[model samples]
Target: MAGEITETGELYSPYVGLVYTFNLIVGTGALTMPKAFAAAGWLVSLVLLVFLGFMSFVTTTFVVEAMAAANAQLRWRRLQNPKEEEDDDSSTASDSDVLQDNYGQAEKLPILSVQRRGSPNLFEITDRVEMGQMASMFFNKVGVNLFYFCIIIYLYGDLAIYAAAVPFSLMQVTCSAASNDSCLVEADSKYNDTDVCWGPVRRVDAYRLYLAVFTLLLGPFTFFDVQKTKYLQILTSLMRWVAFATMIVLALGRIGRGHGEGHPPLADLSGVRNLFGVCVYSFMCQHSLPSLLTPVASKRHLTRLVLLDYALVLTFYSLLSFTAIFCFRGDSLLDMYTLNFARCDVVGLAAVRLFLGLFPVFTISTNFPIIAVTLRNNWKALFHREGGTYPWAVDRVVFPAMALVPPVLVAFCTHDLESLVGITGAYAGTGIQYVIPAFLVYHCRRDTQLALGPGALNKHRSPFHHTFWVASVLLWALFCCFFVTANIVLSETQL
Candidate 1:
């Protein structure tokens, strides 16, 4: 059952692939965008969001191009070394004899005929070549290790964000009534862990308790191979659409009624750093391309499909954020935008309020175990030795334990989802989204030139195929890193 669940079979259509990509990219990050937009001002957020969306789409093509190149290389190597399978047995001929035989056969075949028929789809990005596998194939030892480290850090941040979001939502919803607080209450008012939730328990204590309960419930799944079933994905995706649509309609209605309160600045440079992180995080789908794209059939129009997907995603984000900024006062918007509509008076229904409040608990909780398992698998792959296997205890226990513990500890210390998303997206997220893709495409192009001659071309190469594009991506990544680092240092010094 587990094997079936975790199998990487190519059974999905391109449309399904698009939906998966959409869902994956539009996770917890979207929930934070409203706050980032409010802080940074609508115009700055709008420009940055569109630019980042296009940039992310560019990198997506880079990864797909790399996947195709990796596949072609794999096919070429197999064709060149056809005797590898038989070499294990003593009856096989020597390497020189095999090579001579292959050469003789190649001499008999026409070059164009071999190119046309020998491996017709050699460059098809159909195989499940994961990012890590591609890194191992294209990069040196140091690059491979760095790729793993960046991905691992991003996944850790993902886990910690998930760990904190659910319990925080639960604490908010459950404690709101007890504290006699309305959702419309000032957002700038900070809630402390020291504030009482029950008789003697503070809200922070309730938050910790909920985190403990959340860990106990979902943490065990990391110790085993757990695949999110298709049904769960469908349900969550459906719920996401419903929740987002509801908020947008409600906000638009409020704005139409002339109750809108937002009066944002043109551009706020102070907030650009965090907004950059939030936008980058919101558009992240590069790391999961293998899982999403491998199953996609009829990928001849994949680039177009991806472009359309990004168009829809960008439009959706704009609508969500614009409605948020216009409908509620900038100061009243919650970090999780859903909470803004969680009050009965605001949404005008007890059931809707409950549903909106518990939305994160359902959606984020469903993703936690899956992300944890992915992190665990990546960890195993990072230190994985060829032709070797781990003992059952280490395989089952240690990797998952390592994956689960640190993120939980981070969650224990802070529940600031904004800063968490910002730091994670700014640092590790930038590497995975921008830097790694640039390097991967560059190396893949160079490798293809060497292997297939200069005239050889990747059919799926990104439209931004110029050397300048790769250099631009790297330079932009460097700028973001320096900008974020300076911001962090300034923030620390101020504190």
Candidate 2:
């Protein structure tokens, strides 16, 4: 029971947990936000970002509450059926059996005949139950399938964006200024795909070449185990923070020097559609909350911790984005915001220019394998049969290929990182971040009340416990989908 896979992550202090959660929330999404901010204008982007951040926070509480409910359910089952015995053989499956199926027998803790003198809270989140396992416990078969479907779509989008971003960054840096002495720096000019990168090689061709290299380097890891080691995490986090600081300082310096090229409109509804997706993606730490929050030695102030982290992240995003929009024209902002500094005219130091240009490559390279392996494993779980092992080829070749192929092909056809991020966040992000959590908390609360007698209350229940909150989340998701879809249709018709 102690060595169970479900509880494998290392425990840490509450502050360390705070840092991990913050790092998780702010990643590639933050890097793309400046372009979104510029296009959407200052006031509209600010209002939407604040609203969405609050919504994301509400759902984060929902996930935490569900986790407590999941633990409470497990505890009740353990009390009711200690030895994994079936209470009713005639029934298709007992609740205890279902819990065991979702969270293996290794999770079956030995019940204490008498309660300890000072026991923990009734629904203390002691066990680290994953989102998928929680889904299996609380959702019907179809709901379970839908859960996996949304996650797969989200991961596919994530990989496609990554595939396009790294190669694009490499091309931008090498061709623009980092390695090319004769590189021309046009004021506020945005390059096209047909532009030459090196000699006769086109920018698009250079991107593809680098994409192949990235695939060859990281693709093999999907076929094998690639642990995200502690050292690797530390190195990547360090690089990310440093890069963010450098970009912010550079932008602020340019604005201070009165060399700002930006004169953005106060409002631009045409850009609102993409900005919605970008904001949603930027605040996406909900999916990973179980692993992120479970290890804290104390969760007494967990909600407060999450709120503080969100506030800090929101402020940081504003500084980074506002500085960028003021320092550079909207037309000049690249999909990956850091690439804007690659030109010698924008950033004087060659080393700083190269570092900013290649920042995505360095950080994204480390994350690509971890995400690929996770997607591959998710595929295996989705199709896994009870009491059966996969054939060698299916496990090794088919599953990995299924996980890796679609995204690569999408990246091949279009290197439009903004559209990739927008589409991914708009559809799949809404499902995972809003719709899923709403249903999860709603069902989980009912399951907990049924499992632990009618009187038993979840100690960690969300502050927004009223049924109204769940309904509101679903309604918001519907509105976002309608708005984004209508915007897309209108744009196509205008074109």
Candidate 3:
């Protein structure tokens, strides 16, 4: 399929198939979905996953419909000016020429203007509404940024804490059970003692925090700004594979080993539920929409690809979740990855630890380009030209900005891993992922197409479409409330 061309040489490639689809399947969800499952039971969690999948499906449908509507507007516009090379020849006919040929006089012909040319399609407008609504619902950029920052801080910080803590925790358990000058003590040396620092930081916590902040910087500073970043796209795709493999290996290891000393088996129903949510959210990858949209051959092709890609992603998540739950039976799904980290046998633990540690690094690398892209698109616009070049301004300004901001806030936020994950989940998840998409769909369907002429314009929306708008809006509202109250407030056993 050929791409749609703009007036300039730039081709509209929004919908590049599997690569974009892969990005959508990975991200923050991959980082913390296990936590969501840990909070809820497996049986209940699976059911919730089904519901979330349905919502995601509906949201995807809404996106497709909006894209279609926009394409239709473009088609309508093309018909009005048939000779314009920008028009997609397949969808539009030469209405003006046909009128002139048939009616003999173009002035006498009665042109039917069902819709206007160049109007914002329901989807584009809805996308704006959704973004604005998300920013607003979270209250403001400062609050939203703070909430997200806390999450990155905690997740990264905890990754460090746990890396060191796992070995120490095991040691404490071993020493308390063993006699004085025991054989286990003899086996422990500098080589095996997890405390050996390779850098200035003596503590693993600082190392991990730095790593987290480093990874966290990627998302905001460099993802956009390019017409396309094929190398970065390939890197993201590789991370997708790595995340999948690591998720499987760690999940299985934890599940099979079951539990550590004094800890219950890793099959708690609450944890299972949380895991399911995390699986759906993590594997779904909603944040990569813009990238996925690029490289689409046609609007029709893009729709088919999205539906298929989402279905496959859902299947992958379900299988992974099921395997993890079945293997580790008990209330131990909470902190699933940590269980894996803790359970790594001494013989192979070093390699396993190194592999597990790479997750945060990979996550950080993946997000850097994404953040850069976002800044270039949104913030840079205030100063720079819409499509102007700014010779590594993003690197100089945005990269440094991301590096400094999160750690500073982390210093203030207090690094409790669970609390940070929950708070970020509540604030960012509620408004950004769930609320906004639903709102955009609702607004797009209900709002009339902006008319450029003067006539009654209520014909585009039907009752069925209106119902979709209402149902989606209502569903998102419920999720928003649940996420905010349950996850953000830090109540007993809720998040």
Best by TM-score: 2
lDDT of 2 by residue, 12-87 (tens): 7778888999999999999889999999999999999999999999999999999987777666656567666343
Candidate 1 ranges beyond 4 A from true positions = 1-10, 83-120, 181-190
- Which run of 10 residues does model 2 get worst, by summed lDDT? 99-108
lDDT of each: 0.80, 0.81, 0.42
TM-score of each candidate structure, all chains considered together = 0.89, 0.91, 0.59
Name model 2 segments beyond 4 Å from true: 1-8, 85-120, 178-189
- For residues 256-318, could you state the per-residue lDDT of candidate 3 as single tens digits? 676322222334453442343344345333433532453354443555566677666667666
lDDT of model 2, residue 439 = 95
How much does candidate 2 score in TM-score?
A: 0.91
lDDT of 2 at 256: 93
Candidate 1 positional error at 217, Å:
0.7
Scored by Cα lDDT, where does model 1 land? Answer: 0.80
Model 1 per-residue lDDT tens digits across residues 388-437 = 67899998899999999999999999998888999899999999999999
User: For model 1, which pairs clash?
Assistant: 193-204
For each candidate, C-alpha RMSD in Å?
7.3, 5.1, 11.3
